[model samples]
Target: MAEQSLVFSFFLIFTGAAILATLALYTRQPLLVAYIVLGALLGPYGLSLVTDTALLADISHIGIIFLLFLLGLDMQPSHLLHMLKKATLVAIASSLIFMATGYGASLLFGFSQIEALIIGAALMFSSTIIGIKLLPTTVLHHRHTGELVVGLLLLQDVIAILVLLLLYSGNNEEQSGALAFLKTLAALPLMTAGAFLFVRYVLLRLLQSFDRFHEYIFLLALGWCLGMAELAQAIGLSAEMGAFVAGVTLATSPISQYIATSLKPLRDFFLILFFFSIGASFNLALVDAILVPSLVMTALVLALKPVVFRFLLIRISESKKLAWEIGFRLGQISEFSLLIAYLATSAALIGQEASHVIQATTILTFLFSSYLVIFNFPSPIAISDRLRKD
Candidate 1:
């Protein structure tokens, strides 16, 4: 009976998603928004068709790991390094400004100092999913704007990982904070080096030998990604970071493109679940309390992010048009913000009200940012025929 219920829930989710996706296309809205709405309507807070959201959310996290893996597969190591170098200053400067903005806003709204600090930390990242999903892979993958956007996002992801580590450490005794941080710092380089060595000595050789067997290649790629992901987690680093390294190590392989193309459908399947999980987890009753602050924070993020990013990019010698485009493409809070809120609240470092505020604000920015990108830019799901690419 339990197994049967789980299967039925998945059936409802996919069926509802298809119908909503059709409606979204007809109504000129992003499909991601449709998925989220479907979850909200059917999930625990609504009809309760799917009550075990924690299980679904855990499964859905693989989507993000796979997404980053595919992205790394598309990038040449040299090109990635160059882009990262150019983007470092922009990322650092923009993060500081955004953090300050969030911190000030939370304080003005009467949040405690610790809550304000956590909220400020959450503001430092932009949504990787939105930025990459809306981008037309065929067109933007080779463009200067794409490189800059990808570069900045990567840099921000690194900072976010460190912030998460800090938050985790804060839950421990005060004396353990520095030790925990140092361990994370050490783990990253060690993981990178180990991935490189294994790829060079073993993984590449296996791939070379089995390149003609598509089935075998697929299995091997999946194993490599997940293996590295588990290894990273074992070493106090992020699974996503490990998956990315797994992809980058294989990027120069002749079969990397095949792996990327073949895995896209698999990646999207999990990603839909991920977006749905986001909507499912929200508790609507708390919204009344957090509404005003959520709206204010959402507005601030949407308005200020683009300005700060554009200025930083232009100051670092990027073209004005390209800078502004990258800025707007990133003008939304990240899914990481939601994770930080969850972790902090669970650790008793923040209040439920603050967590709700973060979740609500993140959702609002995601919706508006997707709409902005779809209407104004070249994307896979652009509303305008001229803007639609891929």
Candidate 2:
């Protein structure tokens, strides 16, 4: 197919997404799964209608940045820290188990040790998008369960940032990954200090002065989000993390809710592109090669994550019901998992075969896990009227 104009691309993508989404709703499937399937159907591996996937992937990442930002806007710094402390051991313990599971599965499939390690590292996270989006505010929000779910996810995000940092420094032959990790860790306090100072001095004043200008408020929020994202990247942290800090800094502002509410539509728009890019980038031809290993790993993730999480949470004195709920809610491979595959490939630490295995497994788990959650839980988009809480 010929390259399409930018306008035409948007037209085609959104239109296709809407049609597929309607079908998904009618069929009682998740809208996110529809987005992924649409991408697979229209992307280069399928029909090649949307061959320009690189740009779409880049745009889709902003959705994650904004998602974290909105998440920060809702969270209190002190509360986050307290929960992070409680969640630290759980995240670490669960990640090690998941990582080992992926490693064994990859090695069994004849991957090199390094490839298996990278794959294992990739498997250590769950999809924040799926976890957050499917949660019903009316039922889960403001509850201890909601706090636990959000805290665990945020803790996982921090771990992902460190993983990405290590991958990034792997690109620099002169720098050791451990040293880079320390530098990034040290810089975080400075960045946090700077963000708080800037927000207190400049951001608060602007919000107070222009409290009535809807347009100005919108522009300010967007600029602050992206600016913080850039700053985070500058300091070796992920843009998503930076955006989250930006939101956290403004969490105390009366206008923070307004900014969050306004930006959600924008966040949803970009997230669609993100999920689409996941599907578009997948190479269906590799399915035959990676099929067995991918399925095994997907099954491992689906089965192991819930059990481990539930056990750990229960051991920590959490109720079995809430423990099980959060466990199922987080039982999928994450977008960060895809990023690790891409980075490891870029760093020449893994081969195309290993990367494809990770991608395929992540997508498969995303589809199946989403269905499991919606079918079993109270979700905003659950098909069952009794389970739908939005």
Clashing pairs in 2: none
The alpha-carbon deviation from the true structure for residue 177 of candidate 2, after best TM-score superposition, in angstroms, is 3.2
**Per-residue lDDT for 33-73 in model 2, tens only?**
99999999999999988888998999899999998898889
Candidate 1 structure quality by residue, lDDT tens digits, 102-196: 99999999999999999999999998888888877767443667777788888888899888888888768877888767787898778888888
- Which residue pairs collide in model 1, if any? none
| Model 1 stretches with alpha carbons more than 4 Å out | 140-142
Question: What clash count goes with each model?
Answer: 0, 0
lDDT of each: 0.88, 0.89
How displaced is residue 61 in candidate 1, in Å? 0.4
RMSD of each: 1.3, 1.8
